[model samples]
Target: MTTAQIIYEQYKVLPKRIRQELKLLINSEDEAEKPFSLMEDIEQGLNEVKLIRKGKLPRRTFADLKREMNDAK
Candidate 1:
């Protein structure tokens, strides 16, 4: 069996919640790793989404950026 097959078998043994959390920790922007793992990026993204939902962090907007640039000049 290939290394990938082994890893797949190991991952299959993980508890659903733990596997999900591991995915979150490994999140990245590159899709190259996506075929290997989609749940990873999604889990991290979910946290970002939740933070924005809570209003604790400033939400991003195109108009806000324009206004800031204009003010700087």
Candidate 2:
């Protein structure tokens, strides 16, 4: 049998909760490897803002970032 058929056969033997958990684990892993979508980027940025607001992320001004970039060269 093909690899997919083999996997499906194995998956069929898993209990319902185990199957659901496995599906979630696989899907989350797949999503983690994908390039960020626009909406995902926006949400990430929003999360960063929350961190900044809570003083968890260092706030850098545009000039500070530009100077840092120049210094890195």
Candidate 3:
């Protein structure tokens, strides 16, 4: 397997709460083009899978997130 697969295997064993922390990161990626970057997004995506193995927190809606994000700018 590849590095991603290896990491995924590891992620599959996390508990239920620590995994939810990644929600903060995932929820931050709804914009058309996020400020961080594509590479950063990809890295975050991997982190998302990691969180999922533990337990997926509810995903925020795009509209609410977009509205909140725009308001911040």
Candidate 4:
């Protein structure tokens, strides 16, 4: 079986309290990784800026974004 299947099988046998603790641990790990994920997003935005500067991608005005957000609301 796959590693995920093995892990799921093991997790299934865990007691309720242990499962809750595991969930907390998993959430904290996600929290720790968030800053790195934000940096990745910033890098992606910088790449998009380069594309916009080269005229490979269309750029939108802040007013256009504001209008879109208001429409969504």
Q: Pick the candidate with the highest TM-score.
A: 4
- Local distance difference test scores for all models: 0.83, 0.96, 0.75, 0.94
TM of each candidate vs. truth: 0.36, 0.46, 0.34, 0.48
Over 1-73, each residue of candidate 2 has an lDDT whose tens digit, in order, gives 9999999999999999999999999999998898888999999999999999999999989999899999999
TM-score winner between candidates 1 and 3? 1
Candidate numbers, best TM-score first, in rank order: 4, 2, 1, 3
Residue-level lDDT of model 3, residues 1-73, one tens digit each, is 9999997787778766756765555676655345787999899988887886677854557898899999999
> Looking at model 1, which ten-residue stretch has the lowest summed lDDT?
28-37
Q: Candidate 2 has what TM-score?
A: 0.46
Q: What lDDT tens digits, residue by residue, belong to model 4 across residues 3-65?
A: 999999999999999999999999999988766578888999999999999999999899999
User: Per the 3 Å backbone cut-off, how many clashing residue pairs does candidate 2 have?
Assistant: 0
Q: Candidate 2: deviation at residue 13, Å?
A: 0.9
Instruction: Give me the runs in candidate 3 sitting further than 4 Å from their true place.
Output: 29-73
Measured on C-alpha atoms, candidate 1 has an lDDT of: 0.83
Ranking by lDDT: 2, 4, 1, 3
Off by over 4 Å in 1: 28-73
Clashing pairs for predicted structure model 3, backbone only: none
